[model samples]
Target: MKEFRMAIINLTSSIDRCHNRLDDLDSRLKKIEQRDLEDQPNISGLVATIDHLKSELNVRDQELLANDVEITGISETKEENPHHIVIAVATKLGLTLEDRNIVSVKRVGTTRGYIEGELRPRPRPLVLRLVRRSQRDDLLRAARVRRHLSTVDMGLPGDTTRFYLNERLTYSNRQLFFKTREASARLKWKFSWTRDGKIFVRREHGAASHRIRNEADLQKIFGINEVGAKE
Candidate 1:
């Protein structure tokens, strides 16, 4: 229900601190060994304290696992009349989005596509959730976190997906989010999402029309990365 991020340095530093504690314990234990058992320092309390700290650390790890949900970075904010701009790409020309000569650069303040409606909070797609966890789930536990690919049941079959945040932003800033269908990337797909993190895709003519999360799936579904890559 809640969300969190793991700071690698802070976590490793904590572990390092635990290591430091162990070193201190080792020193005290050695001092105890050097002295006669009857004259040794009070090691009983120290051992108990160390064990208890370890148990607390284990609890922290589990709590981290429970709050492990994540969504990819999508900057758009919801607003009135949120129409998406669609750009037309020439697929038969052997061109790529990077080819420069093939696709038109999103001109400053120019509209290519649009989505209409008042702003509202909505549930995001399950596939997009998994992709974000895979990318930003810095702790690596997201690999096992399962999610469902779905949209809100607004009783509108026309709306294939819904997300928590349905805000929109100006075209130029953070307009694109990338997902790969491959376990390891051989191809890359660009996607857009609602403020709630659900990817917006109305299934079109070809199988390639669906949003792809990894390159392998992209290859299997369409065998391409760029628009032309599939064509």
Candidate 2:
């Protein structure tokens, strides 16, 4: 009887020890969860800081391109000089752009294949880097005023093609601008444009303009869902 009693006592002690250990483990787990909860705000803040830094970097990159201009829809030719084309366009705009004013000019992107019933391959855009931001701004303003500027106006002999000039934007900004324009058109918004590498959209002629910085802004401002469906 005494031996059985001792055995019972041992079992109770073991169970107590086990309960204590389980209690310790539960306490440790709760503390860990509390720590994680406490850290969540800091984690969120860190993510926001990183995003802000990325946006600042994009702005800096766009600033570097302030003195650059992008000319699109000009047909390319073999052994053609892009510098001469820049000069000719400037002359047509009644702006005298000396050789020193132009830093560099080159065609960017791959030449696209000819479309159906088209004779020549689609030409890539020209990136023209100028000595001053004023010169770039002047060219863009003149081009906008002369909305019908064409290759023939620049004295190009081949098929006359309408060309457009605009400020050079960073690749990311360009994508954002494209998305904003697409969304504006679908939502029946009247005007969408970019200025100084920022995208802006308006509902109509006199509606308030909204600046779109990212896709999330598009969703928030336009009630667009993730897949671009109207909410």
Give Cα-based local distance difference scores for all models: 0.34, 0.87
Compared with the true structure, the alpha-carbon lDDT of candidate 2 equals 0.87
lDDT of 1 by residue, 119-161 (tens): 4333221111122223223222222232332333323233444
In order, how many clashes per candidate?
Answer: 33, 0
TM-score of each: 0.17, 0.78
Candidate of highest TM-score: 2
Taking the tens digit of each residue's C-alpha lDDT, what string does model 2 give over 1-231? 999999999999999999999999999999999999999999999999999998999999998998999988887888778899889888888789988999999999887888899888888899999999989989988887887888775776457898889888998899888888777777788998888788888898878989989888988888856326654
Candidate 1 TM-score, C-alpha based: 0.17
Residue 144 in model 2: lDDT: 78
Question: What stretches of model 2 exceed 4 Å from their correct place?
Answer: 1-39, 115-117
**RMSD, every candidate, angstroms:** 24.6, 5.1
